[model samples]
Target chain A: MILAYIGLGNMGYIIAGHIADKLKQDGEPTLLVYNRSNAKVDALIADGKHVQSASIDHIARHADIIFTCMFNDEASKQIIGKDMIGSGQMKHGAIIVEQATIRPDTAEFLASIANEKGLHYLTCPVMGAPPRATAKLLVPLLAGNPAQRKIVRPYLENVIGKVVVEVGDSPGSALRLKLCGNYIIVTMVEMIAEALTLGEASGVGQNKVQELLAGLFAGTPVTDYAQRMTDETYDDVRFSLDGANKDTTYILDLAEKSNADIPMAKVFKNHLDKLTSDYPSLDISGVVGVVREASGLPFNLKKA
Target chain B: MILAYIGLGNMGYIIAGHIADKLKQDGEPTLLVYNRSNAKVDALIADGKHVQSASIDHIARHADIIFTCMFNDEASKQIIGKDMIGSGQMKHGAIIVEQATIRPDTAEFLASIANEKGLHYLTCPVMGAPPRATAKLLVPLLAGNPAQRKIVRPYLENVIGKVVVEVGDSPGSALRLKLCGNYIIVTMVEMIAEALTLGEASGVGQNKVQELLAGLFAGTPVTDYAQRMTDETYDDVRFSLDGANKDTTYILDLAEKSNADIPMAKVFKNHLDKLTSDYPSLDISGVVGVVREASGLPFNLKKA
Candidate 1:
């Protein structure tokens, strides 16, 4: 089976590289790769283990199982909807596995569109950032028809994901799970940011708070994000503020449509919106800067 | 040196028990114990390890170092203020080490009163619930004068706490750190509740979300609280709803006083306030029940 990966951004590039590396270990000739920009594709091809597709349609026409990892619902819709990779372009019974964090409804909508065109679609949005993807440690939340899941399970387990959880038969279930996971992460970021800000404002050293978090609140998003905020190195941008804002918006929209009250999402959305407006280039961890400013501390105060 | 423990709520009882156990191991003759009601004191004395003090004043006068782990600032104030364990009651240079979750200002005020009474004071609020306290795994955030911290560090390290973080020399800094840590935990409980609600509402399984949280958000406040939430067993009240609301209020008041824009804290306080009004007897994890109700689910949906 020809395997392809599209949208070679930070997370996607690392994920695709891992998949390519796995396929190469099995003595596969090459994996198909595509991206809007050429640099990532050029870099992958330069490594000499994968072949770059000329366009998304090239990937659609050639690859049996294609993975798309985009930034948001709009990007996913543009790629899988009529605008690009139209239903007729791909081989019949081709599988489109989506790993982008998008609205559950959008995943269902895209799945329906794929079904009408004789293409099998699966939503398998993953948990973890770029580093985990690079290490092939991303956890996949899988949702599709049982048959479709069976066909994709080997690839997910062997090539891409370390752990794959089958959420349900509905394509949207995986996306919902993805949003739930991202909601935890995003909310955790804001929570830790506020925590550090409160600690600093109250004259508790950030190092002490960081140490306590590492000991008590260790092994989760708390320590990871708290470390970033304490270091004030927001420019590294493993997950960009814009990307985090997108996921938060997706979560809020999902909550509204599902009649769920996620008040923290609303608050987080406002904070991200305000922060992104002020510093569009800042990492999502930069939300700490907003909390610091509110506490009458200079944004990104240097630690003594 | 005579050591005393006051307050015997869920957390305090276990913590005081651990200290008594340590004292017994060290061949110390007795530990001074006090509570408003006689039941807990009776129970501790029934264990045949510790001695019960007649009153808070008795503890103040007899014990060289006293640990107070009350529910709130008012209780702490009453215990150490002029009304109860007054300045003239305790021996000179006696130390009052507070472990209650209270406002930073209250800690400072209590410290000042202790100082005026020729006593040394330290705020050493602990993190963790009853189980952790029982296991002697509680993390303590300690702040006081250098000399006082030195006097108390041996007891903290030997008997009560697994990790002790000296936040600063300022007496209020430790309370602020404790509040910050509790803020992370309380907000995490709410965030996990909202995420679970959103996931369940969007047709994702609660078990799936719980599993994902256990794996990705493991070891932090998220997994422990999310497990309690998904189990719908909020009544095992390790931390009561009222107590959580109290901590949330302390965090919000601290944020406001420090000019920190912790919008999440404001939202969480409102949720806890609403939840406590309805299910005053529920566990803090019952904050999940509030989110579940907001999402139109029953307060405690039985897991299949």
Candidate 2:
């Protein structure tokens, strides 16, 4: 049996590396790694494990299971449309695990297309940043057929993530869950940014409020984001403002369709819009800068 | 020296009880407890430690250090304005610890009035609800003159809280920090509500999202709120809607004055407005009801 991981970006690279390193030790499935850039592909197989660089065509035809962490719907479509599903090249009963956070319609369309071609497609978008990915502590939301879920269970659980939340067998359940989860994260960033700004504006400084948060909200992602906001430590860029805004957009769209009122998310998205347009490369924590600037304060509160 | 605790409400009762219990053990100051309702005062002294039930006037005239947790500024003004400070019956060099979350102007004005009367008015607001208070684990934000802070330090730490976060030596600094901290909480409730509603709308169930939250934010108040949101456990009413809205009001007021742009806070306040209107007696977690209604789901998702 063979496994293929297509897309080696920040998260995908770390996740795929773990999969390759562990699967090589198990000595069962040879991992076929593919990336749009040749350098990333080279980096994946640099350790010379059970991993091998494979072309998209070879992955589509030969790989029994393919994991995709794509940039967006367009990128996923470009690769899976022409080379895999449309080309009629994928093996029968081959499973495709989508680890990308895509729109509900895109996810359902892909799932239905794969079903029509005698393939199983599962929406299994993950939650957590690159650090969580590196630690294999990410939470992967899995939604697909029971049989297909069973096939991919071993690879995802202890191999890559701390736990796998099985959303449902429905086509878009996992994708919707992904949007909901991302909604929580982006809104948390918004909340932390506002609190930090309020602290700074009140002459309490961000550090004291951060100390209070440590006492109250320690052992959470809130602390990590709060630390970044307090001292202008956003250059690490664990999650880009563009990606964060995209999820916010997806969350808003879901709210529109599902008839949910998430006004706070809209505001959070607006902040993300300003942040994304300005810094582009800064992490999501840069939302604090927008908040600080509004409070008649410096963008970065770090002391000279 | 005599120690007085002037409002035996939910939080004050627990906090004063702990302080009285520990003070009795140390054989230091005797605690004079007062409350609006006599039954609450009765319950407090029922343990028969170093606690003594006293009239507000007696607490005003003889107490060296006073801690007050009033219902509102109006109530605080009633007790401290006429009965304590305005009466001119209290001793010189007395300290008034304003544990209530009052308006910023109210805090500063109270501080000024107390200063004019030769009293130490410390804006020391405690963080956490009744449970944390009962556990002697509340975090008190102390902002006042250094010597006064030194006097009140022992009563707050270990006796009623885990530790004290000294916000500043400026008037209203503790109050502002309180607003910022509560902003994080209210916005967290908003974030959790929206996330839970989206989960229910997508048929993923609030429990799954709550499980995800436990993994990501277990040690924070977010988990407790997520549990309440998931099961519609707002009936317990840890913090009432009316009170939560009041703090949100103070936060928005501060944001407006500080020139900070907290659009998400505006959205949160709006949802809270709807919440305060509908379930006036429910906990702040009922914000989930508003989100669920918008998502076309029922208010209570708890299984029958």
Candidate 3:
């Protein structure tokens, strides 16, 4: 069996590299790679991995299983339809697993189309950033038919992530999960920023509050993010604020659709939206900057 | 020296207790106390600690130093004016320290009146809840006459809190600090709540996100609060949502006075306001319940 992987952004690139390493070690399936950017594909190829196709159609035709890791739903649909499905590159009963963060409705629509073509489509978005992906510590949330999951089990067992949580058989379950996860991150950022500002105002010192919180509850991403806010350190953008804000907006839209009262999320979204203006060039952690500005305090003071 | 303490609420009671304990051990200053309910004072009196006065005036007439830890600015002003200043119970140059969380302007006004009476006054509001106060781990943000601070240094150093940060000479400085610190907590509650909902929606599991954030940044309050949110375990209120909302509103008011853009704080206040309606009796951590509601999920569901 051969696995076809498309897209080579930060997440996609790292995931594809892991797959190649897994194939070489496991010897159960070969790795086939294709990226819209030929340089990225060539770069991966130079690492001595198999290059199955320069185009999406070639990847679909040559590999039994296809995995997509892209920016959003639109990109995923474009590559899969224009280059793979529309070109009749996929064989009967071929499986497609998506790892991008996308809207639930889009994933379901794509899945239905795949079903008509006798293709098995699974939504399998991932958790963790680029660093975790490189370290094989990413978490994968998969949703699809039992048989399709079984067919890809060998390839997915260790290649992509540390844990694979099966959300459901619905195609959009994975996407929903991913979107939800992003929502949590933005909320964390917003709170960290506000807390840090408050701590400084109280004369407790931001560093002390950061230390106290981290010590009390040391096993949370929000705490790690809190430290960053307290220190005003936002250089290493594992997740950009703009991305977070966008995800939060999407969640808000979801909440609106359901007519659910999400005052907390709505508040968080407002923070992120304002953050774009406060620290125009800073990372998402810059939300803290807005807090400081509002309290008549400097976000970060220069050491005298 | 004799120290008279007032206001035996959650935080006040612990602080007064600590001072009494210290005075007992040192065998220097005598401890006097008063409260509206008087039960806690009666208990302390029963424990052989010095107790005095049906009103603040009695303490002011008898004690060398008068310390108060009331609910807000109005209460602090009322206790000082009706029982001490207006009653002519204060001794010339006797030091009075206010430890309530009040508006900065109120603190300044109270300080001015104390100054007119030839009494030394210090605005010395503290950080930390009842638990921290009980442990004598609270941080005090103090502002007032340097001479008065020096006079009370021995006792304040011995019992009240762990650290005393000198914010400014202005009467309102300490109150400002307190407001700023609480702004942080309220901001954190809003952010963490939103994140919990998002994480649940994404299938990452709220507990998982909490765990990840805590481990990564274990010293942040964000993690501690986020963990409470993830577990939905906030029965015993360390801090109530109503109280937190009040503080946030106060902070926003201060922000308005400074002409500061505290949009994040406004968002936090709004969330807390809404949370009061949904989880009327739930603790501040129950803000996460609002998030879960937005996600179309139960507020207290365990991961399968």
lDDT of 2 by residue, B59-137 (tens): 8889999999998989877788767899888889999999999986787888888889999899888888787888788
Per-model DockQ against the true two-chain complex = 0.70, 0.71, 0.22
List candidate 1 stretches off by more than 4 Å.
A48-58, A72-75, A82-89, B48-58, B83-89
The CAPRI category of model 3 is incorrect
The most accurate candidate by lDDT is 2
Ranking by lDDT: 2, 1, 3
Error of 1 at B244 (Å): 2.1
Per-candidate alpha-carbon RMSD to the true structure: 2.6, 2.0, 5.9
Worst lDDT run of 10 residues, candidate 3 chain A, spans A208-217
Report the error of model 3 at residue A38, Å.
Answer: 4.4
Candidate 3 residues B143-167, lDDT tens each?
7998888777666664766566676
Candidate 2 predicts chain B with a TM-score of 0.96
Report how far off residue B293 is in candidate 2 (Å). Answer: 2.2
Candidate with better DockQ, 2 vs 3: 2
Fnat per predicted structure, each in turn: 0.83, 0.78, 0.35
What lDDT would candidate 1 get against the real structure?
A: 0.81
**Candidate 1 lDDT over residue span A1-304, tens digit each:** 7888888888788878877887777776567888888899988888775565557777778788888888777888988886444747788888889988888888889999888888888998888877677667789888899998998887778566667888999998888888888888888888888888887776776677787778876656667788889888888887887788778777888788888988887877777888999999989998888878867898878843
